[model samples]
Target: MTAENVALVIGASGGIGAAVARRLLDDNRYSTVFCVSRAATPPSALAATPGLRWLPCSGSPEDIAAVRGELGDDVGRLARVVICSGILHAGDKGPEKSLEQLDPAWMQAVFHANSITPMLWLQALAKGLGRKQHCVIAALSARVGSIGDNRLGGWYSYRASKAALNMLLQTAAVELARRAPASKLIAFHPGTTDTALSRPFQGNVAAGKLFSPDFVAGRLLAVMDAATADGTLSYLDWDGQAITW
Candidate 1:
């Protein structure tokens, strides 16, 4: 860990988010770890750790300033920023199985969670990144979002929102490359992680397919660390292979 390295993990209350934060802490690669979540209180370990900064607010763009306020001058040291928050279900609604199941409100909420929320975080942290550092900003996207892989033709809202996320990530990468040049913006697929978000759908997952949060976190971070050195944005799986858009 270098004195100047700092890592930011948003949605730090969720399973994957918390696990990634813990992994970063154990890796000792960053002097400060900024954890943001909508939770009223931080996870227990984060609350107890030194050099861990917890910011509580709605995971929205406007609330980013509150986190910025807490981060003070530390934002410039950012080397990695990971967005781990996204929704697959709410109330009785889950991913749509057909066009008839689509609800406008649910679709909107999914879009905001999967795409807009992460973009807002990027907007908040994009400036002041030191030009000399190799910075990577990754958003957890889904392979099911891949248009090339879709064959069954279900989960309309989720598929569309994630596809939208890929577009945004790709476009942002182009601009960041032109400006920051050293920074990499990537859309990362965590697979069917064994989290509350995927719990209901896990019954049908093939053996060895459902992954623990820590496992996914480790793989994703490894990919981010190994690939950002190239300074080109990519949509990659946990194994670091490029995903079709």
Candidate 2:
């Protein structure tokens, strides 16, 4: 929250990601807000925002490194990093309702986007996060990822991918404790937000539960503000409540 600190949001072209980027820039706590996305064009809402630097990245190792190179000294000043890259459905592919609907190709694609992509960004940012400055790294996870709390069993690939993401963050937190003691990692579940990601599935979400992107963004930043760098991965929801893993 320091005036001189910087914040970075990957997958900045998406609904929640764009919201977070806009919120950060509006807060004016950070001197610069760097938004990275695979999209060829920046989100129109953020295109004109001052103190916002949009970086085009493919979420590959090389692209991430190139972004770091582009940032130069700003990487060290990063106080918050949010990875919002994830996939639930695309084109003909949708969440599996049953075992019979599962397809290996679709599953693999979901896993790559939801699990591997975020980890790659985490790996690339690890060194930069090691600086003495306090930093919080948060990735968009889901309540469905919680094995202990799961009562409904469906969405096979999406659920598994988020679960894998949680595990990866947990393991990374342990290593980061030794290397970047000042940083904290978070796995966040944003609930049923009113976004394109949930549009096709919102028919079942109870009234008053479908949050707007702005509300989720505010809640997430508040959670980060109150969080401590305890060298653990906190799985939290939009309300700042802990999620069982």
Indicate which candidate wins on TM-score: 2
The residue-level lDDT of candidate 2 at 47 comes to 88
Error of 1 at 155 (Å): 0.9
Deviating ranges (above 4 Å) for candidate 2: none
**Model 1, global lDDT:** 0.84
TM-score (C-alpha, index-matched) for candidate 1: 0.95
So what's the TM-score on candidate 2? Answer: 0.97
**Candidate 1 minimal-lDDT segment of 10 residues:** 224-233
- For candidate 1, what is the total of clashing residue pairs? 0
For model 1 the local lDDT of residue 217 reads 93
In order of listing, the candidates' clash counts read: 0, 0
lDDT of 2 by residue, 1-245 (tens): 56999999999999999999999999878989999998876789888788988899987788888988898777788899999888899998899889999899999999999999999888887776644768889999999999998789999999999999999999999999899888899999999998889999999989899999989998998899888989899999998999989
How far residue 236's Cα lies from its native spot in candidate 1, in Å, is: 0.8
